[model samples]
Target: KDSAEVTIKLKNNRRETVASITETIAPKDVLISKKGSHPTPYDVIHKAADTSNCINIAFLAEGYTETEMEKYINDVKTATDAIFAHEPFLEYKDRFNVIAVKSVSEESGTSVPSKGIWKNTALGSNFDTFHSERYLTTLNLKKVHDWLAGTPYEHIIILVNTDVYGGGGILNYYNLSSTGHKSFKPVIVHEFGHSFAGLADEYAYDWEEIPMYPLDVEPWEANITTLADFKGKWESLIKKGTPIPTPETKDEKKAKNKVGYFEGAGYRTKGVYRGVQDCRMRTNACKEFCIVCKNALTKLIKFYTGE
Candidate 1:
């Protein structure tokens, strides 16, 4: 079937068919079996206050050989520490469970096509995705899902054992990050913002003219806005005295930190605006999520844990 059709059965035994969703299957999208594969064991890195009532995140090891399992565990620790050290997560540390799955690979580093280097990583991740050198990602969704078949996980984080600086995340899908980069800690948290809370990238790129958000329609994300439907966004969080389109001036530095809409976000220099002038989603230096992102994350956590 070109699309997957799902049916919902009501309590009264009534059946309702929902719209079909298309599935894009690539030639590389082959399924791998864990049976007799001697799948590596997993460890509970962070024990939630109540595993039955809290969010569970699983960090899967990629591109790390069996001998380098120690390094993989340490890398997971660094990523976990960085996550809980920030707000929203810090306040709700007890409401999360982190696990590290030691999925040992035959090789120790990911493929860098730009440098003509390739390794037999557990997950076949590589750089130069879509011709973008920094875009690191993997097409092995089946392998990722197969590894977490019986785990109590709602999120997946693949830690690639490479020092090259690159990572990518798709909301509620997966997070792929390098383990040994200088910016690894911050980058993981930033990518987590994308995967965990559906937070949009707050950074703007002047060279590209990518229009991910239409000016007339509101973005589904909680952070960036187009003023088309600001009412549903963080408009109420804006300070009383703050300007609508917060200026990029030194004079408004204090106000910039406030919950005012700052122009330049979502890779666009105009129309789109983010909740704060600086945030973890915007730059690597900012280690904290903006108030708007924190609020959204809190709501998402509550939804997941029924708290």
Candidate 2:
């Protein structure tokens, strides 16, 4: 197909010659491999809400052979249950549609490049992303999206079959997590906060020196703040008599669940602030999301489903 981009001409003014942009389209055959393999089928694990007006989360299988498809399905269920067990998701359980896309592979584990190991996974997931050993991700976005073509999905969770304690999440893109780890449930929930609501990482890191948020501008994430502009953030959630830049005192330790601006957040030791002293976003203690995170997630759900 070929089409010409046009510019509107007003009747009061004579038609002027303007630049034209052309769009070309072509049809290409989608050929299957000589091995006679095709895209795997998907299954609806949980249909709590209708596809037309719900947040559809599709879980894709990685590093799981055909024989382990059953296990992959069970892992998908565990992830689904773990996600909804949290605060905002628990309250809005009926507003989500969970699916499991069965993209089987020939191998049973992901690539661990640091250990000189490789596997023929369906999505080509690997560790040592950007030279970080624990950072897990997949660069095969086209393949992932192609597998999800027929499914109703806005977010993706790629469940790897290995027991390695590694996972990664990108905002509105995808979440990659291992299903067999003991901390998989809590870890997936933490990563989902990033991919689903664009929450910043509350924990500080010591290894890397990548600049995250600028001190002059307000961050768009609802969980962390630099105090650049706290007008629309969790400022309203702050309790009365709670001082700004709340100190980490004995009383603060006693009231660990309070919604005060605790220093040391967003992968920085200072300047940035988190809503609470401890939360799922800050650690893997299987804790509930802070009040700020819960409220933010609630608003995000309402934005998606009007519920």
Candidate 3:
């Protein structure tokens, strides 16, 4: 069935009906599982009642062989624990349902183009994305959706089986990361900040001499800003009397926790400004999302959960 009648309702905390509307919605087309099809197995890592009111996240295996499916589920649990370890997610844990999709690969590891290694993975995910050695991603999005057909998933998290340190995320699309990397926890959460809340990278490569944002126009991301429209971003969140271009703290720890308009984000050092000296979006150094990012994520969660 490609089209169906869906009723979207808004309810109050008291369970009172606030508003309701029904509309015709068409879902994306994909091959449904049949008796002859080798349907992939899935586990409900976290389940919620009335899934219509909850956010569903799918953790799909990218390079795990059939024998490694157990390890894949373990990875999903680890990643889930990492997510709820932070603020907002921990506070709103009941608003989510997590699933682990075990899509076996003929081989056990993803491709590393820089290393001239390729595997016949389920999704054909690989490193060296866009010439960046650490940017792991997949171009075969169709296969990903096909594998996830009939799953109650709104967000996609592809767990690639490799110890390589790399991952990437696109806004509202999906987040992919290496499950075996030491930085897996932080990398997945950082990528989630992108795919879940449309957050931008709060880091830059000044040495590259290429700007990702225009100084004359503000970037639409909730965290970083071009100062062209500072008020449209976290400008109001900056403490009174704080410097516009916030100065770095002498101590790295203090800097990571501080919230201010720190210039250096979106792959450019000068023009773009971020909400903190350092953030989960910036590096794996910080253990959690910065205040500005937390606020944005909180807002998004509330929107999703109708809170």
Candidate 4:
């Protein structure tokens, strides 16, 4: 009936900080059969296995200056609407609820403080101006937990308005936004791909930070793995000639005809895995999710909706 708190130690210093975030069951009164419902915070219900409900998405605008508040809200709402309007999720439109929160724009992360608090960088550019550390630190997990647990939603989606290129994620922690003049719509979808569906980034690149999952083992997720034990997950979707390393191409024909391992995926160089080498989850191109990500999301949708 309430939310839970999580404490994490910083990878750099092993300093412990508590994160406050909430995770509660979706309230019974919030379900609607029609569109334009403006679902309330209390309307977000948590049914991990209920096919009638999807994850509750919450948007947080940490504004140090009042100047950007209104614009922030509108931009984020538009971005979110556009995102869910795509694929498998659009079919279950009524099942998800979205909410927005306004919080103090606290300064976070000494290394990249401008983006406030975040764990990693995605579209690295503006190092400071729009920075809001919505991700890196765990000092507010307790409050976040309380807010989510007290609400009707099971998961919380956070969109930070700082123009920095930082964002973070966990089993249910909020997703950070990239700050700048350009449209961040694609990044919003990309971050959600990580936060909501447990989807891993398929692009390979160097990063100062390491990933949470090991590449050598069969991943616990239903999609994206090193195929160490391919049969454990995603193997059924593999078609013959679909190599272990998938190539990055815009070939729609290839997307339809094969399921192969693409190179430069899973955020690391060594692991051979499956996924469209180019997807929103893998790049800033705002492309559709790979079939692998879709299948995983479909399972999550079914889990929440109880369908």
TM-score of each: 0.87, 0.85, 0.85, 0.67
lDDT of each: 0.85, 0.84, 0.86, 0.55
Clashing pairs in 1: none
lDDT of 3 at 87: 86
Clashes of each: 0, 0, 0, 57
Query: By lDDT, who's the top model here?
Result: 3
Q: Which of 2 and 3 is ahead in lDDT?
A: 3
Q: Write the per-residue lDDT of candidate 3 for residues 125-177, one digit (tens) a residue.
A: 99888898888999998899889877778999999999989888898789999
Local accuracy of candidate 4 as per-residue lDDT tens digits, 48-167: 233434556766544322455566567566766757767776766667766554433433212355535443311121234334433433345545554343344455555554564555
Give me the runs in candidate 2 sitting further than 4 Å from their true place: 1-39, 206-210, 249-254
- lDDT, model 2: 0.84
Encode model 2's per-residue lDDT on 49-69: one tens digit a residue.
566789999999999999999
Who wins the TM-score comparison?
1
Give per-residue CA lDDT, model 1, range 1-307, as digits (tens): 2333454333311123444454444434348233435544799999999887989999999998999999999999999999999989999999999999988889988988989998898888999999899899999887887777777789989999989899899899998899888999999999999999889999888898688777877788899988887896787877688776886655545744667779999888899999887888999988688888888989998889886
> In model 3, which runs have C-alpha deviations exceeding 4 angstroms?
1-39, 251-257
Error of 2 at 150 (Å): 1.0
